[model samples]
Target: MHAVLLLMMMVFAAVMTGCSSGPDYKIDIIKELYYQKDKPSPFEIKVTEAGKAVTGLTVTADLSMATMNHGTVKVKFAEGKDGTYAADVKVPMNGKFEAAFLLKKDGEKTEKVIEINVVKPEGVAKINGQWITDKDVSFYKFINQLQLEINRDAARKNYSGKQLEEELAYLDSQEKVLDDQNKLLTQIIRLRSMALLAEEKGHKVEAAEVDAAVEKARGQYAQFASAQALIQHYGEEKFWDVEKQQYKLIVLAQKVQKDLVDQAKKENPKAGDQEIYYQAQKQYEDLLISQINSLKIEIL
Candidate 1:
């Protein structure tokens, strides 16, 4: 009986030791951005305890300029994938910024501070004469949606263990795919910039044309039970506004392209339709490339 009692006591002590050795809470700042005025600067923070992601935590940041006497800017972070918290903070101006992060989980709170050197980046992304941070944010949202769709398809196929990991790894390593997506985004931005230039040159698309284009797009979804339901499913007000604006921009771009092609054909009256179009496209792309090359584009 005494031997059995001794063995039981040892087992209990071992269990306690294991429990006490579990992970402690920790925070890591993964990504920092250069501070810009009135622009959303994004930061990525990862929270873990014992090297495992900690979910359901409330995270916020207090940002202040380190070198100068700038007031604090408070920002609430939103939860992202893999125990990461993300927030877009706007600092007053460029300088050394100190960010103090407060993390709260289950009534327990922890604090961490990180210093970031903030300077105006030459340019991460741009088109023509316009900065495209807002457009890049929208582009990232589309990229994230595509990633989610890929994950969903993978899950549906029941890919598990090594096979699943390999599949995802392969997808991540597809530089060509990512490059193509970026090129497409750049093309879209180029088109929008061209439209803006056209507008500056006193070329405009009528509101009636935009409205007609939107109505035609809406008509494609007529099989849906209700327009309201379709709109809601696609994000309602914001989606419709963006949709209309995109259509307007596209119409303007098409008009500009047509004008350019017509001018090219007028200059070369004996040229084939294909030849004129090719020349016009080449001219447009060359102009865009020249403008882009003039800007300092730094990919972050």
Candidate 2:
């Protein structure tokens, strides 16, 4: 009789527990996405339900365009500390790109479409509206590497914990300089794509020139056992790839400037213009150096 009574009680408890539990809430991706700068460029995307948060939700973005093609980027929704779902999608080219977000929860899936324009970049105006080239990234990366080296040196010298911490804090401040430069560069590239096209059409720099520039830059690291080892540490293909890209951009910008000067000369032949092409080339080289410095590039 007692066993029967206990069983009845357990059954009642199980029923009550089921009744107390609430239904799983549903989250829908509402269309709101924006880049850091634009208010209405349609870069905002979100999934929300009752102001709560969701994690591990998958978001995929795809783009359809008449000129450029972009496929989906698989991203998992990362929960913000404040309980919001977020994912980052890097835009590839400037055009109208359609994005779809796929959300999976409780073995069910939901998807939505949001369209955004990959506008040509219009960041802060610098000298001549030059597109931020890969070289800008390289310069920023070089500064980061320098800071790392300095921290390593300070450690080797056996600085006090407090002193080392202070030094590291100072280094941290400089790190953001690169981040800002990178953001600027992204905008510049977007704005100056036309100039880039012109450069791509007119001139090509040889691979050997790029290789030589990279090798010369590596001289600062001669203390390392081998250049190969340094390259391996930095990444064999990636470091060299960045160098190649920078050199190509350099060549491209030079050609574009020359094209401009050439047109000017053609428009006025008897003005005794000193080799406008050569003059343009020199001006571009100087500008490159100035831009590098402005970007706070330091080789540690």
Top candidate by TM-score: 1
Over the stretch 55-154, how does candidate 1's per-residue lDDT look in tens digits? Answer: 9889888889887887998989999988988877777888788878778777666777778777785545545434556455465454444454445455
lDDT of 1 at 113: 79
TM-score of each: 0.43, 0.32
Clashes per candidate, residues 3 or more apart or on different chains:
0, 9
User: Residue by residue across 41-71, what tens digits does model 2's lDDT show?
Assistant: 3233445557665555554545455456555
Error of 1 at 279 (Å): 2.4
Per-model lDDT: 0.70, 0.53
lDDT for model 2? 0.53
The regions of model 2 sitting more than 4 angstroms off are 1-172, 181-201, 221-232, 254-300
- TM-score for candidate 2: 0.32
Best by lDDT: 1
Residue 89's lDDT in candidate 1: 73
